[model samples]
Target: MALRGTNQEFGRPYNRRIVLETIRLEAPIARGDIARQVGLTVQTVSTIIRELELQGFVMGVREAPKGRGLPRTNLTLNPEGGFAIGLHVTPIGVSAALVNLAGKIVGTRHHPMARVSPEATFPVFQALIAEMQALRPKGRMLGIGVAMPGPSDVDSMSFVGPTTLEGWKGVPVRDRLAEAHVLPVFAGAELGAVALGERLYGVGREFRSFYYIYFGVGLGGAAVQDGTVQRGAHGNAGEIGHLPLVPGGDPCPCGNRGCLERYVSRDALDRRLKAVDPNATIETALTDHAGVVDAWIDEAAPVLRSAIATIENLYDPETIVIGGLASDALLERLLAATEPLMHSVAERSGRTTPRLTLSSDGQDAVLRGAAALAISGALSPRFGLLFAGEEERAERDPIMTGPSRKEVAA
Candidate 1:
């Protein structure tokens, strides 16, 4: 006996997406289970599963025995169903990777940027994309996800910060890339991408909420709530580096005094090292100029703890993740130095999660996240449809014939 059709309000496309998301989150499960979890009829789920199978997004793995009934087919996502390219543009270089539907990095390439002008940078991006494409199996390239520095305008696809990439102000990066490659393009800030990547593929899969602190050339952060990165008024929500940590201390380029980045970022460490020994590199300073490193840690750790406590109070994330271009050894030392975390609401008893930890993805978090942005855009349900404009709603509305079980069943 077949079950009834889905309600009219939910629509067919929405129901299909619900089934797909259920399988993605919990795979190798029987079709009956999916129907139950998504609150859809068995016949409806079977139809959707058949369609997904034909489209190569899902496939039946094996038959699971049912008590006193026919064996049920268990389904799982097909990792090779689609692919996405993630490219990150930083002050020093550009990195690109091809990620499959399963969130695996199949190919990667990095190119140094001698100049940040559109003229010079476009070729580098083109070359990296070409290299990644060559490495992946020919399939549907969903889109390209670009991760750029913050203080950016997503609508304009332009960099706005005075200290960010030079000559990139008002540049139409997304449009230019889409035109050049003939593929859809998605753009996000560096920290936003990092947080999204973690949510999809890293420790984020384990926790529903957390704060990501990126330790790159400069400090930055992002807040993830239930697997979605929060993008505030502008596209620049996670500019934690510019947060005022010291009132009457060093002047920051952002016109702020004693900003967090001035004390805790890699650039800050370099500056301190240079002040101590004119010729010390980051590597040498860590090994040779131990006194400077210790001093910097002494000053930076307490402030970082304070910032973590502030994040706990404001955002109340389950855990705080520290990651970026900083070396593993440096990160370890920094995490160690920030020990005995300051008091916060998160310090309550019976807490299963630690207040702070290092990112499992390490330096590749942002690049991986750039790819995730594209993958998520393609597969995730469009909740924005509810708030879509009239034109958008009209364009996206699924065709609704007379609601007949047989018509939908077919």
Candidate 2:
């Protein structure tokens, strides 16, 4: 069903999210365009735009002259209007950044960890968050977004399982952060966050639906449809790493054999590199040991190609992007190695986007994605919040709270 909204923000946070998402995606746009895009009336869009302007979230700039009449004022987000804290956690370390409304990273702090246990990591997380909080202007701080590798709450895999960070199984990851932090806490799988970052600031800005493949210490993926990441039951919808591709070939922490990650992840690459030189890290291995990297690509291309074909057939995304931890050069080589991809649903005539693509944002995809996750929670509507008390809703999201003065007056 097409999503239409009441011409008011009285209690409809959904409308607010739609309008904000439309502006962010198609910025420098007039209110009429926003209304048409989001299926809201022009008057409703004008009212919401006025409220957004009043709240300092949006500003209007006169459009460039084209014809005789004066150009309409186009709305764009006010970068200084709000900020979000993004934290990306991995087995190696945790990093945090303060991202502005304009999707710019204003400040960042990264600290490595010998162990990723909660006891050892929380102090660093808190310290970095405190630093970010101190730096951000008051009242504009939205929330904290935590992006970590996960098959959270799954019976087959867990957050604390052999593949995941230790001591995080059954640890309400977001709840733990929310308890200690003043702002709301949002958490997501690292790959999902990466996809969100892509949607918000990268090539994904152009497509309403896209697929993302993450080649980090592990392999994972995410799907975005109609500008929103598809978070499946238990938020583990895109845990493609544990997919059994090579039956009975190798065991996985998720109690599976022949999992895809075993053959195609950073761990797989590092293992290959470490065999050649014990001290060889992924970066050094790429620069110094090109042959080994090429061989690994040759071996992984088929596994990844099959996975890509499966994703294409299932979701039929506008594009398939490969990123995360894998350097651009490596991704390019891998993409090249997977030449003449298998026939799938993506082979439709007149396709605008390529069947597969590579991203340059691999290095900071998680950190930036963590920031996007927080921003999403702050602005996106939640059906759970629909029935929750106003106080609870306000506590959850400070940005979209209560009704407009016009609604109360009416």
Candidate 3:
């Protein structure tokens, strides 16, 4: 049922991603060894190696001398090949990181984004990018990946939010960044990106279907079905923040009363703690009202259990992960408290309860997810031209390229 495309054809641009993945998982490998490991022919591997070398994306290290006359050429990812700019944009602040191919943060920067629009944040983003660029003069650039507050058009790379990103509503973020930095640009909803990231490199592989709950300044959810995120017909499928759980509660930005976010988000917690400590900082409020936090979780866990049960009844995902600014400690407490609440929900619904787990990916889940989205898109057929050319060969003949098991791996 799948369309046919040769490794040479379908994997031109994808070669980089594949090679990077292979090297990331298995490093200090001979070029021929990597070719074999990745199913690419040695010739194709050589070509990729040469390309990566020219682009400063990969480097060759002379293998230790042995009984062999010539030392084997070992290839590895060049830490300076380029850097990916990851932005976790929130209403309160934007946390940015310069991540290398190995998924390590080489540099980090954070700034308050109050009343800031994309245009307004441009200078901050530019400075951050410049700082990262300065770190590796030999390297060019891959692109910028932004994990923004939802709702977003995945196809259009546009933001559609009820929050604080100014001039962000409908602007093609990719185009703007592409023009500004003269490099590829990618952006997506924080929750969607987190889901993708988890699926590819996090606990996402543990479940065929799972729900990712992101508790930040607001609350958001992402649903993964069959290893792919279900973006819905209008790309707004996972808008769980406005789930009307209360009959007559405080109003939400979505013009809905008793929205789930109003009851469970950090904002909600802050509002509740204001009575105890009117001048409490976000962290202070949380620390000041640990009991209130537990009480709120006691209330929220049932609602969350209901939400999880609904997902199970509808899609039957294997597990649910809680993430975002919600602390791991808080998530542990929430999970423990939700156990009884979930049991209650299961008793009422007469269905087996799905597993509830704290997100292992932590705050970086959404940002890493954005990077995964960019990598996936870059390797897709629609965007193959960026890396692979039309003149690229499909495969090499065994006669011409003897013992090409490595290329076959590619």
Please give each candidate's TM-score. Answer: 0.83, 0.85, 0.75
lDDT of 3 at 204: 70
Instruction: Give candidate 3 regions above 4 Å deviation.
Output: 1-42, 53-82, 153-167, 205-208, 341-354, 379-382, 387-410
Which residue pairs in candidate 1 collide? Answer: none
Model 2: per-residue Cα lDDT over 91-142, one tens digit each: 7788888888877888888787878898888788889999887775453777
Candidate 1 regions with alpha-carbon error over 4 angstroms: 1-18, 36-41, 63-71, 153-163, 274-292, 383-410
* Residue 294 CA displacement from its true place in model 3, Å: 3.0
Task: Give the residue spans of candidate 2 off by over 4 A.
Answer: 1-22, 31-51, 67-69, 134-139, 159-162, 381-397, 400-410
lDDT of 1 by residue, 13-38 (tens): 55656777778878888899988877
Model 3 residue 389 lDDT score: 60
The residue pairs in collision within model 2 are none
The total of clashing pairs for model 1 equals 0
On TM-score, the leading prediction is 2
Q: Rank candidates by TM-score, best first.
A: 2, 1, 3
- Between prediction 1 and prediction 3, the one with superior TM-score is 1
* lDDT for each residue of candidate 3 in 140-217, tens digit (9 for 90 to 100): 445678777766644222332334354566677667777886555787778788888787667776777887878877
